[model samples]
Target: MTQPAKRTKKDKIGSGLKQQSWILLAIVLLAALIDYIWYDAHWVIAKSAALGACLSYLSQAIFAGFVFWHTGYRARRHIVRQMYRGQMVKWLLTVFGFALIFITIQPLSAPALFIGFMVMQISHSWMLWRIG
Candidate 1:
């Protein structure tokens, strides 16, 4: 059989970025839909779940933004430093996001909220698993 065509660094990076973003969205939406139907959620529960999932998605988006933003860098030190900064930024963003959500939204469903957040976070494993 013929070998697959080799991908350039740009192609590889772009593919993974797009794949993960699209897949993450799909997984979260599917999960939220399932949650809504299974729980027969009213507006409060449904809104809480959406907010939680949005926070989770925002964290990953921050990480991906920082990582991809520096792909043009040639220095290894710069790349490593940027990655470290990305982790810190992601953490801070997550904390802020959760705080903001909790502060603004009343009568939040902790169980549903966590379920949405955790489900989105756990999707990363399946994404990586498909690669290896």
Candidate 2:
């Protein structure tokens, strides 16, 4: 059996991102489970939980993707400008996502949606602290 090649700094950063992604997934699952128990196994609660998780994950992912793509081959000023613009677009996307969910999903449980989102949002800070 051969040993794996040593990883570069970029590889390490990629792995760290993967770890954070998994943590986000776990947070979503836990939120769903809590909602299931709190709402007596109602499907609506589960749906709301899923939607909330999707919103959080998608928003963060889109922003990260844009940053990674734009900063790859750019000057420092260009990167900085893109970062600011990316933030504005990311926030817009997030708000649009939430609005779409609320408008489309009838009888949604507000608590479930918020709880799911909040857990993932807070997990970002938790992951950063833990990683540090």
Candidate 3:
């Protein structure tokens, strides 16, 4: 049987990414609402927390994309190499993302931002661990 086309694989991954983005955004919106209504958090803090979650999720998604960027039936060595590349790129993206966000976003709550990032990162890691 013929393997799937490269474009097809990429398109599938892209769609999955978009779907996950939407899910994460929805979760953040719900949390924002609850924080605003129940906790009496400032709008700025909620926005900052959402941005932080997005940053964490995006960095992780990029890593997953890189690892699975080009594959059908691949050798073990190739997969390992891709994983290493993904880890390096993910680290760089995360650091740069935080730097940019902090500099550009004003009136941000550092505690909330850190909490959002940590929560999302942990959940994402747990989900992947369960699936894999």
Candidate 4:
């Protein structure tokens, strides 16, 4: 009898990352709509909400991509090592992302941005709970 091929660690990581991304995107869009309608239907507020949500997600996505770029093609034996490296990179990217967003986006709505971020971050926990 032939045995099924084993999946690589990279494949497992990719699938989990994809699920995370989708959850973030859905929550971001929903938050954007709520921000728009709740905040006097202002485009600025809506845009801010969307940007904040996207930036929050981008922070993680960029790091995930970096992990894939640096480790995905490497030997599977190095996965555990790569995970630690990936986490450090993710943290750095997240800090840099927030700094960049704050510095570049003028007339930014702090409340909207923070609300979007908070909602999305909270949603992540909710998602994990549901999944687990």
Best by TM-score: 2
Writing each residue's lDDT as its tens digit, candidate 2 over 22-123 gives 866776577668767886766677778767866876776666665554434335577677678778888998799889989999989888788777776776
Clashing residue pairs in candidate 3 are none
RMSD of 3: 5.1
- Predicted candidate 1 versus true structure: per-residue lDDT over 98-124, tens digit per residue: 888888888787776787678677765
Q: What lDDT, from 0 to 1, does candidate 1 have?
A: 0.68
| Model 1 lowest lDDT segment of ten | 5-14
Ranking by lDDT: 3, 2, 1, 4
What clash pairs does model 1 have? none
Give the local distance difference test score of model 2.
0.70
Give each prediction's root-mean-square deviation over alpha carbons.
5.4, 7.1, 5.1, 5.1
Candidate 3 lDDT over residue span 1-132, tens digit each: 987644325555555566567657865787689778977866766777788788888888888877776565555577678889999998999899889988998978788788778878776765655444
Query: Per-residue CA lDDT of candidate 4, range 1-132, in tens?
Result: 988555445565556657767766776577667766786655666667767777666666655565555443345546666667778876787678778878998867878787767766676566545544
Q: Estimated TM-score per prediction?
A: 0.71, 0.74, 0.73, 0.62
Regions more than 4 Å wrong, model 3: 1-23, 38-42, 72-74
lDDT of 1 at 15: 64
Could you tell me the lDDT of residue 74 within candidate 3?
Answer: 54
Candidate 3 global lDDT: 0.75
